[model samples]
Target chain A: MNIVENFDLYAPRLINKKELLSAGHRACQGCGEVLAVRLMCKALGENTVIASATGCMEIISSMYPTTAWEVPWIHVAFENAAAVAAGVEAGLKGLRKKGKIDDRYIKVVGMAGDGGTMDIGLQALSGAMERGHDMLFVCFDNEAYMNTGIQRSSGTPMGASTTTAPAGKISSGQKTWKKNMAEIMVAHSVPYVATACPSYPLDFIRKVEKAKATKGPSYIHCFSVCPTGWRCGSHLAIAMGRLAVESGVFPLYEVENGKYKVSSEMPKKLKPVKDYFKGQGRFRHLGEAEIQVIQHKVESEYQKILDKVKYLKAWD
Target chain B: MAKRVGMEVAVAVAEAVGQCDIDMAAVYPITPQSHIAEHLSDLVADGKIDAEFVTVESEHSAMSAVIGASGTGARVYTATSSQGLMLMHELLPIASGMRLPIVMGIANRAVSGPLNILNDHSDIMPQRDSGWISLFVENGQEAIDLSIQAFKIAEHKDVLLPVCVNIDGFQLTHMVEPLEFPDQELVNKFLPPRVPYATLHPSKPVTMGAFAMSDYFTEMMKAKDEALKNSKKVIIDIWDEWARMFGRAYKPVETYKAEDAEILMLTMGSMGETAEVAIDALRAKGVSAGLIKLRLWRPFPFEEIRAAAKNAKKLIVTDRAVSFGGPGGPVFSEIKSALYHEAHRPAIYNYIIGLGGRDVTVKDFIGMVEKVIPYNAEKTVDTYEFWGVRE
Candidate 1:
């Protein structure tokens, strides 16, 4: 007579609850990009079809005869993920119209890197939103073109040392500021647009859930820390991402059809930008003056974001 | 069975679209290709073609809209030229890789730099390797015919790939000719509705264009390769069926008076028709020369080319576009590579001619034939030579 005799020992347990991303993948250890994807898929669940642009996420998950994706997926090209996703959504609608498909709740998601999203894929993404397709576009931002070696992308932050934006005697690395993709999405007047980071998983998950719940087009820009390109330990990916949010370097926020709302609030005594920049090799070459300039820009942008949230809240 | 008269090639293409079973046409107008989109838009407005006509902002959006519309398993069509085609270049491979059977009419024009809007093959040549089944049409009738055939070829399950029907910009797209419009019933039987793989269905969901790690990237490419390679046979079958139904036959390589010919002239697009005039003149001169028109540029008619060049001692391949800094023109290099293993490969010489719509007269063709003489006499040829260039 054992304690097991007092209860049912062989009850079927719900072992695997994770949706979207499946277990096996080729992403490097502690890769933040895949982690963001995992969370996105988890929130999206199984009824979502993904149109992926060629990037690290695509390269790491899909290989010949094998895929880490549990759901149906497509890898179109580097710049047409949004376009392909639109096609999938349209195809889905056409199938529904013909009574060939019954489920109407299926989600169409497009995932691309910053280079794909902000540069090459921008027109397609803009078109999709303008067309008012029922889809979600997710841009996994690693700042630079990490998949093709550390080349500069439109989203690469100023003072970051990428291969294309190498610091030299005559010039500072990535002299331009990151492109405001969230604002660009808002310009489309899409139903939803949000910014999230892996550092704040719950907020990111919530934003995705809200996006899935919304109609028409929605965009989520997720800040994914690239340890390889950033010259940091893989384990520090999450820490770096957290620092980005805590330092207000990358703010957590959402915009609902032009209504802005900051999701995470920073303390008045937040860590300096240098504390965050010093952790990554990309900003290792930044001098005091450059760091000061970056800090000023970040502070100004963060205040603007805060003001927008306040104004929207007051209007609402 | 309805009859309507249209002069411009774009209007004729629009008429064809109206007559066919197309569900949607997404378009953004560019020079030389605008008439087709505009006419299609008019048809959509007039309730002639029951389809969604999306006027996108850019060529990129135009292609993107079509991709979305086609993904929904709808038979889709679009048109673009030169700079527009270049702008949509990034999406061409995606459309093919996703295996969406989208057909586009591309007006071949010279690319920008000099900002010319005239006819040439340079615009479409760069897209030769983008995994699309490229078909070159010489005139208005062929334009109408190929547009219809393009849909059938693209939607074929065995050949589920995108297709680009190349027509010379001002030469064909702006010209008018009598085209025998096919019966609606016949077209319906021929094309039917598109059946796409992995369409977004709510009940049984599927994913397309998924992220492939290195572990499986090669296999995804292999799948596309296999599909494209297999499409050659399906294309031939479709062409045969089309010929049987419409009494107009199309081959990957169409030969004119090639039997027992000693000299063969190869060309593509509208330039091929010009070369035909030269072939007749050369025949009159007792040169025993023939014209071989390359109809399908991709899935390149390697076997057909080899067979056509079998009896020839000298093959003069005239490419309208230059491959710059390379051996010969683009087409010649491809032809040479294909015939490299053949036992009776002929002496092939490449001539770049009629770039930016330079008038290629029968004399130019004769000059090309004359230039091939030294190569045959010496049993050696410069890989390529420019024709009609001042220098």
Candidate 2:
């Protein structure tokens, strides 16, 4: 394994201690999305320009006169972050080729939330990836539209209550499965596609580093836990992410050059999905039958990744 | 030395953009605007121009990509028409508000209920409030000249705003005419490399397009408005410089045979030439008919409009797009609003004509003047009518 893959051993020495996203602006207490952004920025370092979509991260970090971004950043609109990043990449390349600017390799990154990515921004992202711009798009999937007060998004998990898909006398909350954005990006045939969570910072940082080194398009789907949106205690945010990965609800994996490799170690007997849903109020309305349905879906999804890793030959 | 060549207006506009030494262009193909995009793609593919040509999937992405490129301090260009322009409407204000100097070519076409891909000002009429510096061109030569001048006007330090050069679709964009191509050396001398006010650079970190709330929203809007209003001076200065360099003069409002006329007609875009021909015919027949061509639409050219119409007893304004339930024509409404407070305002009449590529002949212009000659502004029940509409 490379040094970044084995970064947990030499993290203090290998990591750049400089923080790109500054401290103390307006992120909620224990906001997993902001935490994931912090780790990703640390891996990106100073040689990066970010195009951020209007979301929780953009709102918290940039508020008129103040800003928390230590590197270059821009927020164009809600659904065009990927398209903007592609423009930045092309602009830089054009400038360098004409000797207008220095030929330093600057990584362009697109950042958005679940609603911006899986829903409104999907077309722009697909076009950018297909065109093969050297950029990274990181979707901070907090399940629902946390920025808009717990509205249901395509990334929202089934049976999870939201403002638009609330559990009532007749409704059982979100009816659809969480969109598999990682697989959707993988289907674009990009150079790198990965799933990560702030619950495992080293693993998440390692994936970001790999994506940064990627020549063409790279996508990272971050499973960010929203304590406020999920109607859970803020202190349990990290713990909830841990529970999610351990219960196989959100598997950690990476697809490099069409080859699948599971990043996290799976238990011989995976933890039950009920354990992941116990503290979250969004899933509290579900009965045993609903829990069983979720549990079955989680097991099968995790098995699909495992099976792909086992069956697919390594591209290298 | 400038050289005159016969070429299609759309291709000439693209070639003019190439002469500006742009850094990037992001365009999506649409009717009447596809030729510009095609030629630009070929220019980049054949290495004729040292630029990046981004073939975006939709007009929204095309506008968004150019915004991003301009934010990164790249000299950028793009083209679209009608439905494509409507798709780009959301980002137009954002581009102007951020003060990104992106220059775009608009092939003015009719918007659809029944889908017509032809010449009209309906495409650009709805974007009046988009905060862009809008310029209308009459023919192929003006199309090429304005396409080159748009970059210089947009990138001026005092006027760092997006500009749209509107050419009538199929009327001017598809027509072949002899156009004078400005020399590269002169264009380079006129338009230097862009020095962006603020750019996304790791060396100097800055935040662009930040969220503005009630505390600062009004102030931000005020800044944008002031910038657009102040751009008129810079626009005139650039036009003066172009005239001195190329011997082809342009103005916010151009007049033809209006010096000693009692009756004047106003027009925009390609219809200006037809109206001028009509004026010549009226003058030969001993009628005091004149023409006022409005080249600048965004700033409204209030002073120029008043100056041109101050001596005339009656002014007929022809519009190619209807303003729906509000007013008869969008241009007529604007001119009425502009002349409302003027002390020496002429009696203005509106004629909504040439909609959806309905050909406006020279005789049609003559007919409008004759139709409105007998009516008095205060006594007439309806001062505006849809001309040439089948009864």
Candidate 3:
């Protein structure tokens, strides 16, 4: 946290030289998930045991006989990253008591994809937070099951064309709205919950440090862009993330204990939602009416967040 | 001084585990196995034993939590039965492959289609090849003895794998019997403090349960297989030590009235006690029948099975769980495979019996032994019939 600086709008944010992920990884070109993870690992330096769920991050980082992770990591089944992480936390607590080992500095982290965290692993994630384990769970939200060939996930945005929910003659794309996983973690009364994007590495790093500082369970939902799945060029990943934030589509915010505050700086007014949607072909099928509907929903959700911040700040 | 007290087997098991000085327990409530979880939580609440008790949401989480805990070099325990055991099917191998040495209690019950929450081996049969040390207990005393012994066996340096103590649901778990409570002093002497070889630590980190590619995957599987196979020696050693200290002898195979018998019957878990009664009745008649009770289910006790069947002309194997569409039962398939290369193997007949808590009387055992005696079991070996099954 002391080392991390504010996001410099005029220039690039300086990333740490100590790379936790190795030089060679199997992630696709312009894979924002790995970039987000690079920043995350920089925040949670050594002395962290990461229990990664089965998904793109796990698959790319750990190909047997080789691994990109320098830190000690484990990949159990898909639905139990948080559960396994909780076990690791409990295990350390027990070992410290019986083995007479000082493990105060050791931290456990759970990492999963949008499919793993929001869908298959939600129950384990919720249970871990409810039990109040000292750990961090970061959901690498690529919005779909990119590893399984662009299948729609619960975190997949509405109107995005996926393998399961294809853009058809009668249908626009995915019919369901994306699940609010950050709010779900917040409802668990978690000590810290935040939403950050890879495009904003400084904000992402600071939040990871905040979660690391929290005494109990903490969660970070990192909005990751996938060029291969989002039907964009490899270089457009960061631009997609920026357009998402600038258009008010994916607002960066944090909920500390109970109080809510938007973490990322917002402009005087938001750019049109069309600027964000037009970059990716997944939303190319959306008509003017569908675009308006999405814009209206995103604006309303953003307003709800603002109203909560205002009311909570009034007490302060 | 240890004293004998009448108590339910499940409670006795939890008490035995509490005496083991375990560090943590993560378990879910499942039918027939609920008593173990309930009593363990009570023990923790009463502060009789100092441990972290977590009531997980599902059996899957229970196993996962135990794996996590065990990976950190903590002595851990958990229990489940039937569907609960079935739910943990995916993580069973991970516990063993990681060499975590977790001790789990399986209150053996039938898996469902008809959905019966009663005594059967279906629960643990599916986990036979999960590279865990499996022991079946016949009664409350065996349950208590084996539950305590499981931790020692699993934590044995040479056998750094998971151990599962299987007691038949409702049959052993629900029954009350007079059992000797080993004071912490005796348990401490017999089962010394566990020394983990490696654990998750911030100081000296180690990667456990790492992914193995094709080049090393086969070797990894082989190593795990070898570990489980070699655990047989450790299991026998712990039983011998327990016998020397407590004066209750335990063996992979226990026999009753097998002296100069031409016909033999094999049973596992709680069914062994019932089959002994059948042997006594058959001896009352001129029929020279004997009984062989298998105590160790995994590692198969091949040498013991061969010796037990050496003198007998026929062996009637009874299984409570079905293999369905292939073999008559899981135990039967293993017996056939174990005795496949015997130079003087006896005729083996498998009887799928007492499924889903259907009561199998002493008369049923006598009848099965007699029915197999009439047939030339040598020709009938490797095949089976469903005993007491409707026409």
Error of 3 at B174 (Å): 1.6
- Predicted candidate 1 versus true structure: per-residue lDDT over B332-361, tens digit per residue: 889899888988778888888888877888
RMSD values, in order shown:
5.0, 2.5, 2.9
Return the DockQ of model 3: 0.56
Q: Which model, 1 or 2, shows the larger DockQ?
A: 2
Candidate lDDT scores, in order, read: 0.82, 0.91, 0.87
Evaluated at residue B332, the lDDT of candidate 3 is 78
Query: lDDT by residue for model 2 over A132-234, one digit each (tens)?
Result: 9999999999999998899999999999999999999998999999898999998899989999999888889989999999999999999999999998999
Encode model 3's per-residue lDDT on A1-316: one tens digit a residue: 3343533442244445677877798889999999999889888887888888888888788777778887778777889999989888887776676655674678899989998999999988998889988899999999999988999999999999999999999988899999999999988988789999989877888889889888989999999999999999999988999899888888888998789988746655888899999989999999999999999999999999889888874223
Stretches of candidate 2 above 4 Å error? A1-11, A314-316, B377-382
Model 3 per-residue lDDT tens digits across residues B166-215: 99888889899999987788899888878888777656655555666788
Cα shift from native, residue B73, model 1 (Å): 3.7
**CAPRI accuracy category, model 1:** acceptable
In candidate 2, the residue pairs with backbone N, CA or C atoms under 3 Å apart (3 or more residues apart, or in different chains) clash, namely: none
Worst 10 residues of 1 chain B by lDDT: B200-209
What is the overall TM-score of model 1 with all chains considered together? 0.85
